[model samples]
Target: MRRNDHVILGQERSMSRCTRVWAKFFAFGALCAPLFPVPPAAAQTPAQGLTAAQMREDLAVLGQTWARKDRSFTPEGRERFELALRRTTTQVEGMHPHDFALEVARLAALSGNGHSAAHLPAMPSLPVRLWWFDDGLFVVSARADHAGLVGAKIERIGRASPEEALQRVSQFIPGNDAHRKVESTPFLTNPRALERAGISPGAETVALTVRDRSGTRRQVELHADAEPARGHTWEVLLPEAMDAPGRWVHVLDALQVRPAAFRSETDLEYEWLSSEPRVLYLRSNRIYSVDEVRLDLKLFEMTMKELVDSAPQAVIVDLRYNMGGNYLNTILFAQALPELVAAGGKVLVLTGPVTFSAALVTAAMLEMHGDERVLFMGEVMGDEPRFWAEGDLVQLPHSGIEVRYSDYFHDWGNPCREAACLWATRIFGPKRPISLAPDVRVPTTFADYARGADAVLTAALALALDADVGCAAQRVRGAQAARLATPAGRACVAR
Candidate 1:
């Protein structure tokens, strides 16, 4: 999209508590606190069961709210939802609250939009935290009592193989396959989720088959915590940041150095990687602006000015850990990049399963505006380019679980023209098609992670170093011409 001036009618809703907690857990790479603290008396009291009528009423409200507000809702999704509802209604009398919540979550996932979900209450989790690496699912962290399990590869959970468990758990997550993988980590740690997914019997303890670094295979029984652990949709912790001392022990705690990508905790940060080549590295951990966090417009402007002044031959924008915020904050930054590095330079965007929502939008914007110079490297993004977002949450009456719905549509696969753009004109202008696939795909492997190596960053840096820095003659043709037709385009060409 090319626009000189832009206006946004409204701000995106703040990250839901579930999302916020996930962001914190991943960003900090440690267990901080319980998601929702319960009073001592409340913790001691058992959960009151709900009647079939109350559960049905909650489901009805959830369906009605989604039908009314979610613009992305489709006939196929609605039909499937109704069918599931009918089947579940008949069985609610015998179902537990946790099982009912999973059913509701599965209903929300039917929309196929990442933002749509049923945010269930925190559930008890096994002491160990598992992460899916390129090789397989492995334990990255564990409560002090189960520290021996850390770094062991998971072969099976109860009777189900790791692959089968992942497939079963995928039903409760929304969005594309990539997003499902990103959001399934926390759910995999929950014993209730494991039981619902048919990976284990509903019990306080679950058996796991694991192989340690020594290559010895053994079955380990893990018990769930007494208190419910806070869970979020996205929870990938950086291996290097596992050093923070807490109730949990991380496998990589002995490592002394943190990789460049995990070095900063700020929402936005930039530094010069090489003075001779004039390579600049910018990492945006979050997309929103909050003055209290030093992630405001002023910081953004200053960063952009430095980028322009540096005249870097190559720039790397890392969004692997960004779960999203306000994409509008980076519109001007995206628009200015094509010309900024058009002359024999490159713009590299790093994305992964956690690069979602507004973070995905930022990468799309870079690809749309920077054209051929913009290279995407790393794993697939959390969501598809064309997806639904910008909505609010509705809490179910009896269960109190929050179900989120999407009210706006954003298409990066096709240009946004006239009515195709659902939001107000003030918020967006004519947008161009953006391809989200990586030019170079680099998956993070457990071997690299265990040793404190960043294969993705290494590959991107190598590509940047090998790239030719001369402007192509055909730069002003087709899409380039269309971009150059605008004032920003003319300015870019003049530079």
Candidate 2:
């Protein structure tokens, strides 16, 4: 399809939490937490019937089994976690299952590992789709008008707040990642609670008290809507508001090839909207090796070359759904911008927590190339420069689990310094002691994506056209006849 702008949700998981099986008690812990209060380590106890000794044995088994296969964790880290487990049992004796699971999830998060997280039960597809990030939870797709909820924190769903419901549901579902406890819970963390609060399948409407951007408290009655047949999560067709002044473009890089070493299901897939005269929007869905190098600069170069050939007044490069592949492609994409290189124009880039690896590299590269002509839209770029490796998935014995980490770190030492090697990072890059920042940060919401509320894209197009008009006037005002001869200017005139 020739979509001028496209939204691509590339499902690229370096590690699959779904396939791997973990401790049942951990699952119980994840699901049971809603039933009782999560006690502090010192005050906690195992289920009422299970002795402290049994809890210790169960924890030992889980830790020992997990440790046998977990190469990411240090021996010291494992030992510390084992000690934490032993200490936790002293508190687990009299606790409810839900309470115990919460503590376990807490312990897993404490492991300070990205791979460690709670797993929630499979949700019966609700009309809501949420994109979870460290900063906050975003409603990417929803059936509710949710206009009042565009940016409001869904503190409570029905009766229980998001946190309370998560604590309750996590008792049964055990997560695989150990880094963020909050990240592990699924969208249906508190279905029962949400139902009680009047957000159930049969409910025609939901009542919500929301806090607006102005910090004013108000109650909004939202009508239930149907999910869009196509696209991810919630989908809403947008209306043209030509006067609005914000633009955000998600430039997804769909170039690059799979390295010969680790070619999986997805390799060298390029599907995007290109060659539009008014605006050139390119999205890179994956990062693959262009040549021998890890960063494929040529693919981005080609994308820009295409845009320059088409000579669109504005271009939006969306890398929001791009999962790390070739790091250099982004840099190449920045260097290839027609405005910066040809028209002396500008590009607007859309980003978010979903922006990772080569995507981050691309964002960083734009800054380095003196491309002030570029603007960033969406939530903050993933602060982590994760070292990505396409290698063999090694399964550890006993645990029946597989783990993947990169063999090297890809760092672009410029405006945004990245890791030289792969270690423990906020996202996945080096331990740079600090994180990178975005030029202009915009939050992503369900309404924005649904309504095609691409503030960045709109802004980029406006700025591009505005700049183009001014530049065209300067260069070709009295020389209309001369401008007509130029193919690049001809399309703008035709439009």
Candidate 2: what lDDT? 0.40
lDDT (tens digit, per residue) of candidate 1 on 1-495: 221111121132344454455344344212322111111111121145777888889878977776567666688887887788778778888677777888888888888888877776666778887888778999887778888888899999988888888889999998889888877877788888888888899657899999987889999888888665532433335432445545477677766654556554446666544444555667766775434332334333444455555566787888987888766556667777656763689999999988887788788878878888899999998888777777677778888777777766777666655353555222543255557988889999888777766777667665665632221111112121233355543443343
TM-score (C-alpha) between model 2 and the true structure: 0.49
lDDT by residue for model 2 (320-431), tens: 6554554423433455563433355556666765455456666656655534566676556543433222222232232222222223334444222434343222232222
Question: Worst ten-residue run, lDDT, model 1?
Answer: 34-43
Report the number of the highest-TM-score candidate: 1
